[model samples]
Target: MTQQSATQGSTQAQQSTAATDAPLLDVDVRATFQEQFEALAASRGEVTALIDATDTSTFAQLEARTNQLARHFQERGAEVGDFVLISSRIGSLIMHAAIAAWKIGAVPMPVSDKLVQSELDAIVEVGSPALAVDTTDRALSVPRITDLSAADELSADPLPAVVSPQLKSPTSGGSTGRPKLIVSGAVGDPAAIAQLGRVMGVPENGVCLITAALYHNASFSDALAALTLGNTTVLMERFDPETTLVMIEKHRATWVYAVPAMMQRIWKLPDDVKFGYDLSSVETFFHVAAPCPQWLKRAWIDWLGADVIYELYGPTEGQAATALTGAEWLEHPGSVGTPKVGEVSIRDDDGNPVPVGETGEVWLRRGVGEPPSYHYLGAEAESAEDQWETVGDIGRVDEDGYLYLTDRRSDMLLVGGVNVYPAEVEAVSDMHPAVLASCCVGIPDEDLGSVPALIIETADGEVPGDFDGFLTEHLAKVKRPRHIVGTTRQLRDAAGKIRKREIKREFLEPTAQS
Candidate 1:
């Protein structure tokens, strides 16, 4: 057989093998999801699967409750195309409920469980989920999930056949004025899922930690992969550095998936507080919500004493575009490695492929083992033929084919008539031993049109005020920040993307009198 045909046959064999043993739940997408969850519970037995702030759910318990919720929604007025807005904090309840929603063929809109009333209102107003399932009363008037037993009054609609995993609508970042609903879909490609599992080293017996919110795509994939692999998952409702360290020690979580900011916070805990936990159980210390500073990554590697720290590069619309392990990362330094199991390329301004070594938009075409599975809700972000797509990132390929992400084109700063990429300045700022995390932006300046500004979030001993002098030592005067801001809390969104655009509006936008 030719190489192309051989590859095709190989994929077919894998799918055929999976079909024989893999009992997809109902038949359609909903049953497939139900089966995935049920299989995990059956295989894992009483393994502690998820922990919320106040409650814990074992695999069996989670499966039982999620099924009840799924039955409730199925009985309610939910339809395949209808959106199910799940608003809850990070917990087993929310994650399992989302799986149940998927099992019923209803599109699940995962709203951040931590959102205040106003944010929840905005999302609910835009998404308009047919059923609003919230666990907590973050908002006074929202419908909340009380109990599954009570759901018996609802109808028992027979589950639909397997529909493809498609997102009917998506939650926007609100980078612009208002967040709009985006049409999106999820990929059900087994090859891509298998490749992601391999890269994550998701063990059949390990417990995967979901520290990121369920609403975010990265977290969604993390939860799905954990269930698909029949492993236990521990969910963190909200990340508390001390709490996280304790949980790692307490639960003996085998794998952790977190954003760089959270890792920085965990590392910043006093050595006495940080070292008390037993992290030996964590084999896959993976992260991918945002660009991790080399310093932070190095700190984590040293702290974890595990060589399994991995980074995945992909967006909401793009899942598992590429991944790199800690060992490979040290060898390549800044590269996010080659495409995980797909094809990655850099496209220039004109939409043509840029020769290797030149910075351009990073684009991916679903490759041999990675089939195209995601679809956008609307034309705002288009996915075209050949299954190629870009997530607004600028990057380049090295001579060895490793991918180096420079910055997001949207986050680029124009300073003093010169282009200043915030990633560059943030990289320099992060080099400061005292600085834990930082974000840079161009503030309006009459003298230079726009000038670089820095917002620093200190680790334990670091101070934002001290960052300016430290930054001056590492960067040119022009690139130095005109102002420095500070925050003790998490600075990035759920996906670990710094809300720089939002930060600019809150601080720099008003006071940059120029």
Candidate 2:
């Protein structure tokens, strides 16, 4: 097994390399993947690597299974640098294939199995995979790796001892007008992986539970952190609040990584329900992907203690740029944390640095010597100014250098003269016991210019009837959503990201100038 010494020199050396230069830092990433998998198999032996309602695979068993499936993919005409479409219920097979695809220099395109056929068709059309491993026996001509492969009929090839590139594919957002694919050429950087492992405090013997969708970057990256950092991962097919609680105890999971929504769902579990399970083994509860409600943040701190919940903010385009410890969160209630070691700056529209307390667009330039390398499939004109790029989030930094994001600059609502961040209002509204979920948006109002309107999902247990009087107690007059709407209407994506433009069209489009 190849092991690079976990030293400061290695980390600095890794960080110094330009982002566009090497796919993986120093070591052979493919070899690293195989070695770690083998190590996991050796150490864990028969311990489960993944668990679902109908399946469970021990670490040793999963390694063997993945090896066999890797052979199948090779036999079915899959070659190095080909995209492999992975659309299946999240399980050991999908997890195994992701590693296998990486080993063969194939990029794993993990798509949601829950997506409508049209959406799947759209992705498959554009992703253009060499092989697709789908669970259902459909009419699609792509090669499929079935459950029978777990029996292990083939010997595993010695994974490459040199790093290779898997053309960086962007996460497509269909809701924001046209679907865009952000092509990032940089392969999985092992050094960055190691740094993240340090930030996550991943132990050599740790096991992580993935409660979020595998299609999302955070879930995939967190799972990889375990493998790359020499730890086992327990994959859950789908996030179930009760099942997640049960599995945390059943697997004796050490690290828990999930989105705030998933955590809130777990928080929704009755006190008696949580008491029935033993999750004492869990050491870190990490939250990322979406902006978490402050109330949910407080509740997590209250339930599991402050040290348990750590929040990180970053985008798929830039990777995780900032990490805030729980204690740091107390010092400043809204700050995300200081900029990452490789990151720099928050700037205004005129490209000038904003004052400490003034809100502006978050702009980041890679550390010295980092090169400019980003590709977009649909949008042609690229934005590159001396290796600096902004991800369109509006935020401000405090005197101490902590960053606080207001909202997506595009989504900010200008209410008369008072600029309002939808995220802040939504965060506060989400804390209400009667509210299952809430999305705050500004709607055109003659009286207040653009007034805050909240679309809410009412909790089943708490006030299932009236929302107005219940909302009054929790919100201030100005911040209180002037208009309240039910969430039953198609107002948000499956990920719970509010479709503000869609909602705005429903309410304001007709009145627009023709």
Candidate 3:
């Protein structure tokens, strides 16, 4: 069957299943976050709600702890809609704090716990959160609450359930520019949470695994969805490729979230070791945050059944989303799937819609009369008329309305009047057996205006001698890198996103004045 017809069939099946299986709860989308939790706890009180490698907490236990933390936050002068900056390593404690903030009607803004004081300061300067929770010894101007132990002395009795006006304020990865807060438009509501859980295919009372950092939007959302569905969520403090496989087997995880970087690492494992664990329990293996190389995606589909592999494409801003199963992806190869929630339009510089198969800036719009799903704190969104917004992504839709991404428009290289998208080059490079990770950036060239420069992270500390031959065979001559650099250091972040602009600066800084 064609991709479009197959997708439509799948949607109809899902809707039918949902109508039959899902309970008709009187869930209020406007209900407070705390109220939602209280309802969940009452229903799934004995179920294991959250699990780390070492510790597990039931829904009842988690709700009680969150209530205690809510009182602590209140004592620290955190009021409704107050942004609480949470800077701590991923653990059960961070989840408790986030829920506690929601309980007391405070917004949680999670930043990377490993960030230096300067990086923390920049985010604080922009967000100006009312309370700061950093286990580290950094002094801050805001009221500081160090660890979960601080709430140890507080009462565990349930506090008044309250809801924040804003659900969360997650920061961007700062790949292309400065880190900015993307505050969610929707408040903490039961209906919204349930809808997200359904959309992500999170099952009730099932086991879910999250390997990415809690600071990342994808991980955070996944965790929340799992918890909302009363699933047993296994939180990994940090991603270790081998450990990830072991955890899946140990926990019998039915659903897991990963990025392409993590997948590549696992794919590199010895065949015996990689296949040693029983991964048959996994029903949905969802990957997002960055593009998955075609080869990598195919390998995964081959390893796991196509029905178990799923891909999501969307920004954290929640404006729209597209998703596809591996079976559907095989039919539509590079497409990110048709829009599941909103409309996508490809437009030229003049703001006119382009023909099918023509590349242009990809703009997304929610249903008619829908407001922007998010607003920026440190930067404004790139928006045009009638709520059409682009996150600077460039892509095209085929005749079947399946969207295929090129690269970010800001990351495009102008090479002698020909456009070169770094993602295309990097995707090709990542296919090489020796390459662990790769990044492509545009470097200044006097003759051609600019040219592509490739930076590779090899499997070992050394690059293969025939690396150029691999590139020549994979990429066109114009798209080939003019300069190649290799390092053992990783190129992508935990979420598998590359900071091409930052990498380009390192090569350009010395000759910038010349």
Candidate 4:
């Protein structure tokens, strides 16, 4: 957006928001994200800071509103180091709550607004947040604040600068459906965040567009990075493949954060619609949170320039990470790239370093004297002495140091004495054009001990006639799924994460009945 267009729909309280191509946070000033928000307001105050489907906020507006809301939370008993669980539909309130939490030196824990009462209870029990926003419908264990009108009555004047010890506390629950808060070990400093962003391919002070739900790690990471860099970020309330392209074109988005599922959906769009948008503005196209099918990655690389495609792989814990450009990926086809952060290694169950090219647990230890990358609230780290930890991922590194993940140890199936990786099976299932998403889980088999059962979400909710033959050609016999089920029911969440345990349970009932 041009300077004129960005300020058009901004808050009328003060319309002097300056839109510039320059970075917002001054690394030299030594400020937390909270103080940087105010600094941005002083310099880039009138610039558009956040955008949702129905509203846009300038830096000035965000600073003032967050100030008022910070006082609101402080007055309601939230304090430094406390968790402010944020759950709301995407809009001004979401950003307002997050920035407000930061202003008061509290950690903002964003969770899915669509979570049911039981799910919310489980998460709340773990974090035990001092206060919650937009979760008004429940009789929670803590105070639940909903009305923003009262906050409007509070002073918008700046609060005393306070930096949170924990940068953020995003929730994660893979397959097990057990929610846990991942508290970042980094302080709430923009300089550290900016430094990390650069290594992760985040463009500074450019138009950023996000399609995933804000609750996800990647979504909030990009959103906050956009804010820290003074970039105008456009957020979609829900993802629509066609609308994603429209927003990119309309905003002239220079950076986009997408997961493989989202990327696949966009590519599945009619070629005319997919290729119609002016995507030349996109300098970085990012995908993570799930393993991308090689075919899909190739398609995106062919469509977008190889340099524009960026893939990052790591746990949200942040201790271990690997990244690859499309060009690098072309050279190391199935590799997730060498480590750009942390000291990553592959080790056997005995904690001995695995020989290169042999699959084992992927381990990471922080840089010398560095604090832990993250600490989990609900569970202990799967770790060893000497600051080494594993997230239960099974992978191997090539002699060249490129890492290739076979699958999660918990997700791997032992089929007739063979190590069957569900990712390999699912990747093949997703290779079929009709498949939108696929999950492979192990089912009880009298002969093989356990067999792969694939549940796929397709356009017509029916398995294609040629899918069996397609699977036969792409996957080995031991890796093949014995049962293939089709469903119209949504499989993956908005963040492109699938719940394999749920998939297995649901599919198992029908087979048992038959």
Q: What TM-score against the true fold does each predicted structure earn?
A: 0.82, 0.83, 0.92, 0.92
Tens-place lDDT per residue, model 3, 179-221, is 7899988786555656665666677779999999888888887
Over 387-465, each residue of candidate 1 has an lDDT whose tens digit, in order, gives: 5566778888777668888888888777777767788888788776566677788777777888888777754534655
Global lDDT of each model?
0.66, 0.64, 0.80, 0.81
Give lDDT: candidate 2, residue 83. Answer: 75
Question: How much is 345 displaced in model 4, in angstroms?
Answer: 1.0
Which 10 successive residues of model 3 have the least lDDT summed?
A: 14-23
Worst 10 residues of 4 by lDDT: 12-21
Q: Note each model's CA RMSD in angstroms.
A: 6.9, 7.0, 5.7, 10.7
Cα lDDT tens digits, model 4, 1-514, are 1111111232211211111122233334347656788788998888898899778889899888888999999999999999999988755577778878988889889988888889889999999999999744765778888787789899988888888888889987755577788999987667756655665677767888888888887778777777777788888988889999999999899999899999988998888999988999999998888888899899999999999999988788888678889999999888788767766667666666656677887777665466788999998877776577778888887766788878998998999999999999888888888999998988888888888889999988999999999999988999888889999888888899897777767877577445
Selected candidate, larger lDDT, 1 vs 2: 1
Count of steric clashes across candidates, in order:
13, 1, 0, 2
- What candidate 2 gets wrong by more than 4 Å, as runs, is 1-30, 136-152, 156-162, 167-170, 182-185, 188-198, 372-374, 380-384, 447-449, 460-466, 469-478, 488-496, 499-514
| Local error of candidate 4 at residue 35 (angstroms) | 2.8
10 residues in a row with least lDDT, candidate 1: 14-23
Candidate 2 lDDT by residue in tens digits, 378-436: 55522345555667788876776677778998777777777787887777666665566
Candidate 1 global CA lDDT score: 0.66
Q: How many backbone clashes does candidate 3 have?
A: 0
- Cα error, residue 353 of model 3, in Å, equals 0.5
